[model samples]
Target: MTQLSSNQFIRNLTIQDIDDCIILESKGFPPEQRCSPENCRYRLSVASNICLGLFETTPLGDSKLIGHILATKIATERITEAGMGKRIQGVENSGHFENSRNIGIHSVVIDPEYRGVHLGHIFLTKYIEYIRQLKLADKILIINKESLIPFYSKVGFENLGLTDCRFAGLIDYDMVYNL
Candidate 1:
């Protein structure tokens, strides 16, 4: 695999990226924490643009996806609604992706080999900029590992305390970044 560099570019994900994304997701997260393939496909099919990918150019003029951030938009009110609220546990099942004012950041993963280079920060910064440019949502929320609270804080996300939803059966915190 080609090493990622500063020349890396961020772009909207495409259908062709699903498989690679699933592979990376598997590698980056534990089985229970992994989003199902069906859900991954659903996100790509419905909200491809908001699903962002980080790619680096290869020596042979190809590009390889090294990281990705998947998110969906949902209304604040619907977040507390019955079935719709439960779907917030993961973006794939969220019924409000078609039209909503809040952006739920479902998952973010980087190639294990590329972990220490700050790619997560770079990807999130660009994603936030993109969201701001579109003005699609007033806030962005994420359920993440408690250990990562500091990491997300650096990106302007404020911790809202532990979430009721247990993704992968792990204790997770809900954090939000107001746009």
Candidate 2:
């Protein structure tokens, strides 16, 4: 795998990244598990939390977004933003952690063509740092596939427990990280 240099640009996503973000998500996951356009838009517009995108400058000097990390408030605030869909409360157990105002890491996706690069880690590290800056959350909750456990573990996440989840009829596990 190639490592990203410290200078790589990872920042808050903007409206211009919508198509790239959606395309990257589709590359990483099935259609049913991907965030809808409206959800991505909401993440981009949320006040206290944010979604991030990874971009690399091309040889010609233009930059292209190739990865994203999506996060949102974990409690009643999430209820207001999401308006009752799957209600990830099961995966988001940290929502009530006294010292930590939880942030649900709803998705992380990289462009398939960019898979062998460490942009995913870069994206997560930046996202976590951003969350810490707000000091609103010291913990992050993730709902993910069992197969990705090793990857998340390497990034400081642990298996909080199992959850009865369904996505295109497939099951998943709930993972957490106390940042």
lDDT of 1 by residue, 1-179 (tens): 23336668889998789999999899899887776787778677777878899988888989888999876666552222221233456555444456677877777999998788788887898789898998877888888888899999998999998877665567788888889
Each candidate structure's TM-score, on Cα atoms with residue i matched to residue i, is 0.86, 0.78
Report the error of model 1 at residue 42, Å: 0.4
After superposition, candidate 1 runs with Cα above 4 Å error: 1-6, 77-93
Indicate the worst ten consecutive residues by lDDT in candidate 2. 76-85
Candidates' RMSD to native: 4.4, 5.0
Residue 175 displacement (Å), model 2: 0.8
Q: How close is candidate 2 to the true structure, as a TM-score?
A: 0.78
By summed lDDT, the worst window of 10 consecutive residues in model 1 runs over: 77-86
The candidate maximizing TM-score is 1
In the range 72-167, model 2's lDDT, one tens digit per residue, is 656632222232133355564332223336667777888888776676776687677777787777567777788988888888888865645453
